[model samples]
Target: MKKNSINRVIGFVIVGLVLLAAVIETGRSVYTWSQQAAKQPRYTIVIDPGHGGNDPGKIGINDVPEKDVNLAISLELKEILEQNDCRVVMTRQKDEALYQAGDTNKKVADLRARCQMINDSGADAVISIHQNSFTAESSRGAQVFYRASSQEGKKLADILQTQLVSGLDPDNRRVAKANSDYFMLKNTTATMVIVECGFLSNSKEAELLTQASYQRRVAWAVALGVLQYVSGGLS
Candidate 1:
């Protein structure tokens, strides 16, 4: 072959080898992901949508109630988890409170009832979804709170916080926090984390939280975090 032809042929061979390597790497990545997913323990999780019925929780800048936002995200997370072969138990599937009719101090009753459900379900983990509110309207991003005494809960929370910050809220600067004050987290027998999905007090975040696409993104990130925890990916 002529020198020019030989040079062209060598260049083509190098390009082909590079493409082949890329394809092999992609295949390896996919296989690894599938194997990890298959190795994940089948988990039963309790998804608590915080503050329903008379308890509207925080009111957002767009006038959307936090209860509704919480429920929306929880429902989406439930669907995603179920699709991944997880058994999901929802604390409340509707707008109604968990407390029975004519209950005195309905708020306390509602929380206690949720705790009972979490304990009775024998859940592997619990995710209580809520929207945050603050005196400052600039406060934004997702935050996760776990039981101070539960190491597994802290791990889960850390994974969730990482996923939320990296995938959904890239600007999020919050870290996973240990909170002993939340009734559900404090009382649940299972490893538990409370996800404050975003700040409803922030106009920008509140607008995003209300959108269905953003809700789905938040749910997907949470689901991935759960799967990662169960599969020992975080370890």
Candidate 2:
């Protein structure tokens, strides 16, 4: 072969080898990225259906019991959370009451039992769901409450509010705050939030609460909020 032809042949072989090396590197990068994605933490979130059994909670003008509403919302919320790859645990999955109320303290004891379940579930946080009611029919909108002294609770609540407001309502009504009176908020070992999902006393809000479409929206917004917290941090 001519010397010039031999040199050209060598140059082509070198270029081919370089191209092959580039292809291998690109494939390896993609495979490594996918593996890292698969290894990311799959967080678990616990949902508490506030008020059950004899504890009817606040009754609406339409005679819709608070416990029923709490459970319904909670079940929907669980579905949303699970859809987003979060493992969910519910304190009450159905329309049963939580406390027997044998005595004034019996109700407290029952609440403690429920709280212990959330604490023991090994969940990152507990979202205790409930509906609000007041003498004023005009009262409406969702609210989020948290343990005032808990740094983790505050962090989750803050992220939740940012996510909740993004798609649900622009208003900051559902922000987290110190709520010492709630038994669940006070007792749970993990960071806790008690969400009052609108006022049943308000006629318009009460009607909206019972609708399936509205419930789905509420659940989705809640799940997004919770995810933002879980993915973020307690702070």
Candidate 3:
């Protein structure tokens, strides 16, 4: 062959080898991913949408109830989790309190019932969805809370806080906090995090929270956080 022809043939051989290597590497990566996916533990999570029925939790400036927002976000998160092969148990699927309609101590009874459900769920984790309200209408952003004593809860809370701020609210300054006051976090046997999605007191935030698209984003962030935790990303 002529020198130019030989050079072209050599170049083609090199390109072919490079392409073959790339294909092999891609196949190996795919195999590794499949193995990891197959070995991944199927985690069960309890999703508690706070306050229902007569208990609206917080009333937003836009006249949207916190219970509705909470439920909406929780339902979206459940769908996302289930799509990822995780089992989800919702504490309440509708706008009704866990306690009887005529119970005098309905609030307490409802909380206790939710705690019972969480404890009995045999879940890998619990995420209680809620919206915050404050005296100041300017207050905004999402916050995450976990039991102070549970390291796992703290890790999950940290992941959720990071994801929410980065994915949904870029200006969100709220960080993960430790709390012993929440019944869901304090009483649940499984590692739990309470995601205070946004402030209903803030007009801007309240409007966004009431939107289906924003609610879905919030749910997506929460679901991503849980998936990260389960995939050992925290470790």
Candidate 4:
């Protein structure tokens, strides 16, 4: 019963994201009828909002936590995808660790567990959310990364970053290929792309990252980018 309740809560949150995406998609559709009656989309998109629970990734100018931002944007992304009819799964809902407490090897075991969840979900693709930080605030903009082992991973990264640049920012931040050393990217069985949405350390970008409106737009860009890739528009 406890596990079932947790699953329900998770589902509600995921469905909320899907609904937000649906509402946006419905508004943009050629007509409401097409959106209402369209057959279910043929893809399942697993959204892994990185660094939750005690792992609060990069701290921003206002001390905004990276885990919180990732969750917010990830929820928005799930909305955009579900509006377009994609099934979605999330790694964690509240700010809880994926692994049980008191585990000796927590970090690696936890990360691998997250990957196992994605692999078990039978998702077509996984998008791991993260925020970036560097000494250079000038290093602002979105970047998509893929595992070196997967060729299609490169294509997915290209499409997502291209769409983000063209639709959200015209600053061509470029796509990167990373080896399995990145934990999540290296271990997930599904076609995976990790997104460094923007640099949080930069004052200007940090301000934008904190806004709900901008987050939704970023989510939309990501959703469309993946769809474009899936539809063969970015090949």
In candidate 1 the C-alpha lDDT for residue 88 amounts to 92
- Candidate 2 TM-score, C-alpha based: 0.76
Error of 2 at 36 (Å): 17
User: Cα miss at 106, model 1 (Å)?
Assistant: 0.2
lDDT of 4 by residue, 1-235 (tens): 7999999999999999999999998777857667665666778889988888878889998799989889999999888888876888888766766777778787777798899999899887888989989997677888888998888888888788888888778866566656667888767777899999888988888899999998888888889887887667646
* Per-residue C-alpha lDDT of model 2 across residues 42-126, encoded as one tens digit per residue: 8878888888877788888788888878888888999888877788888788766565547567678778878878878888878
Off by over 4 Å in 1: 1-41
Q: Each candidate: how many clashes?
A: 0, 5, 0, 6
* Steric clash pairs (candidate 1): none
| Per-model lDDT | 0.92, 0.80, 0.92, 0.84
Q: Please give the RMSD of candidate 4 to the true structure.
A: 16.4
lDDT of 4 at 1: 70
lDDT of 3 by residue, 1-235 (tens): 9999999999999999999999999999999999998866499899999999989999999999999999999999999999897988999999999997677899999998999998998988899999999998889999999998999999999999999999987888999999988766777779999899999999999999999999999999999999998888763
Which segments of candidate 2 are over 4 A away from where they belong? 1-41, 99-104, 171-174, 233-235
Candidate 1 least-lDDT 10 residues: 226-235
Off by over 4 Å in 3: 1-41
